[model samples]
Target: MKKPMKAALLSAFIFPGVGHFLLKKYIPGVILAGAAFAGLYFLIAKSVETALQITEKIQSGEIQFDAATISELVSGQTAGAESQLLDIALAVLLVSWLIGIADSYRVGRAQDKNVDASD
Candidate 1:
């Protein structure tokens, strides 16, 4: 892989999709970056926190989000596939970043060439 590709991949890996921004695919990269930091990701993280608390409660024989105790606060009835949606969105975001890395790699490779000075 070219330097630019490596740089872009490194940035995307380090910054969660900023590599695409480096490639001038601003809209997509930004959109993905934003989504990565917001919405469903946030929600699932919250769910994890909630689950943890519930687990603590379970140690006391009083779980909350447990299936038999209080049930999932965000369920299929309450939030249909929202978590799944986030997973898919992140997958797409990752893909876009990868494509950006490839493009940037190509760009870097191009930059290393000695163009004919005739023009």
Candidate 2:
């Protein structure tokens, strides 16, 4: 496979920045990877926190956990600041992943051109 496609596929299939790292673009790779990880971490943390809060409310009889009340309870549980953070984290992760794929492909193409030019 061509370097550009290979790099793009790596970044798309693997975590963001793997392709850049393979191309020896350490700074971009590290930044993309770090942002992705941070977004994921925040998402997981907020999800867990929301889940725990819901569980606590259910356990204490403040919110009933039944088919009729499930929707209401779940919505209410996630209707606070944490939900907004989760949304932002999701957006950031998605954007970073896309940028990483495009960047890695561009870098790979540049490297390929350099190789050809020197031939």
Candidate 3:
């Protein structure tokens, strides 16, 4: 396969910055990977916090240990500012992933052209 397509596939299937790394673009790779990691960390942390809160409520008898009640609690937790923050985090991850793929592909294409010119 072409270098550009290979780089794009690496970024899409693997981590966000893998393609950039493949293209030897270390700085962009680090930046994209860091942004993706940060977003993922926030999302996981928030999910764990929500789970702990629900567990505490269940243990305290504030909420029943039923699927419906748990679902309702989860739904309630995703509201207003927190929901907005979660959305932003998701957007950040997505944007970083997309940028990594596109940029890596572009860089790879350039390298391919350079190789062709040198040949």
Candidate 4:
């Protein structure tokens, strides 16, 4: 396979910025990996907190186990401000992931171009 495609696939499927690592772009690879990990951590923690809150509400009879209520909880509308923060965190995680993929792809392509030009 082509170098760029290989790097892109590695970044997309394995870890964010792995393509940069493969191309010996250490600083960017580390930065992207760190940011992606931080975003993922925030998202997971918020999701767990939301899930625990929902469970507590259900057990305490504060919330009903109906479709609409469940929908609201899942949508984070009825949960309050923390839920809003969770939504923001989730969006950040997604955006970061996408950006990581796109950046790695671009870097890989550029490295391939440089290699070709030098040949």
Q: What are the TM-scores, per candidate, against the unseen true structure?
A: 0.45, 0.85, 0.94, 0.73
Superposed Cα deviation of residue 43, candidate 3 (Å): 0.8
Over 4 Å off in model 2, which ranges? none
Q: How well does candidate 3 match the true structure in TM-score terms?
A: 0.94
- Superposed model 1: Cα runs more than 4 Å off: 20-32, 43-47, 63-80, 110-119
- Name the candidate that leads on lDDT: 3
Tens digits of lDDT, candidate 2, 1-119:
99888888998999899999899999999999999989999988876877788778789998777866766665776656767877999998999999999999999999999999999
Model 4 spans with C-alpha error above 4 angstroms: 61-68, 76-84
TM-score of 2: 0.85
Question: Using TM-score as the measure, which candidate wins?
Answer: 3
Ranking 3 against 4 by lDDT, winner: 3
RMSD of each: 5.7, 1.9, 1.0, 2.8
Per-residue error for 40 in candidate 1, Å, reads 8.0
* Tens digit per residue, CA lDDT, model 3, 33-77: 999999999999999999999999999999889999899889889
The better-scoring model by TM-score among 2 and 4 is 2
